[model samples]
Target: MNAALPFRDLSPDAPRVRVTLDGAPLDLPDGANLAAALLAAGVGSFRATPVSGAPRGPFCMMGACFDCLIEVDGVTRQACMMQVGAGLTLSRPMGKVAE
Candidate 1:
């Protein structure tokens, strides 16, 4: 193994953990919000339209807009308002309906 590879030491400053999103494993930063983390992970959409089945993501990161809504730990929540935690399980909503 190449010793120079990054993330070799998952220390506090270099926090490393895995999270599951829509049944996919994702590695995210230690203290970032789900919205931010998803964005950084190259996720352009976080939700689907109720009527048309289109895609959506964070719009007003301050919790005013309902665009960034998602399900965390089996509960509906705003992705922008929830911080990313280790072993978190997230599922994007297909629409406005609660699951």
Candidate 2:
């Protein structure tokens, strides 16, 4: 994660970013990373490892790793790499990775 690039923290007056998670609408901060947005929505697991089937979430927010995979707009993608956009539908994968 690039801790140097400051991100605006959630506040009462902050404008809402409309997005969908698991078919439900979620209001998050504008320009938030997908991991942070999903975490705010109480989503625990974003993906599983291909070899171990281990659950993953936001690990290295800088996109160096694929630990934050999630389905967005019907395409599986790296959550950490995506900026929170309006009308995004996020979901977890159902298939398990090979061990």
Candidate 3:
């Protein structure tokens, strides 16, 4: 676990797998909550608001809040509701520009 991050992995010895975040490679604990893993790995912001472009990350952490929205395998998904898996390609969803 990285001490610099705000969150810590409870299972420090858990198995790790490779995943890509915004094209950057990251080795995260397999089967862990995607949001929690990203947070533990020092990911500060998950996405930007479509309207304001303000940064946002996990909030409710229970699939209620859409703050953790991210693009995974070409689909927009809530990071908090998904698990860390090998070969996952994650990226911040593109926000619509104000007209």
Candidate 4:
């Protein structure tokens, strides 16, 4: 679970961009990191471990960590490394994750 933070409270006029995640629509800051957007939206687990089924969420907001890996337009990408784009589709990467 994500520890809730004051998102809009941080900036009353922060610009927002719309995006779809796991088939759900969300609005987030246009320049905010995608991972942060997910977290702010209370999406805790980005994916589950293929082996132990442990929940994996973003650890580092930088590109150094793969824990935030997500499916972007059918490609695996680190959510923390990208900004929210309007109308972008994101989902949990499924099937045959390397062991």
Off by over 4 Å in 3: 1-5, 94-98
Query: What are the Cα lDDT values of the candidates?
Result: 0.75, 0.73, 0.88, 0.78
TM-score of 2: 0.72
Best by TM-score: 3
lDDT of 1 by residue, 14-83 (tens): 5657999899897877877667667766676777977777887888889999889788888888999988
**What C-alpha RMSD separates each model from the true structure?**
7.3, 5.8, 2.3, 3.2
Q: Which model scores highest in lDDT?
A: 3
Clash pairs, candidate 1, are none
Worst 10 residues of 2 by lDDT: 1-10
Note the clash tally of each candidate. 0, 0, 0, 0
lDDT of 3: 0.88
TM-score of each: 0.77, 0.72, 0.89, 0.79
* Two-way TM-score contest, 1 vs 4, winner: 4
Per-residue error (Å), model 1, residue 71: 1.0
Displacement of the residue 83 alpha carbon in candidate 3, Å: 0.8
How does residue 20 of candidate 2 score in lDDT? 77
lDDT of 2 by residue, 28-78 (tens): 767777787666556667876666677777778888888888899999898
lDDT of 3 by residue, 21-56 (tens): 888899999999999999988887888887887888
- Report residue 60 deviation for candidate 4 (angstroms): 1.8
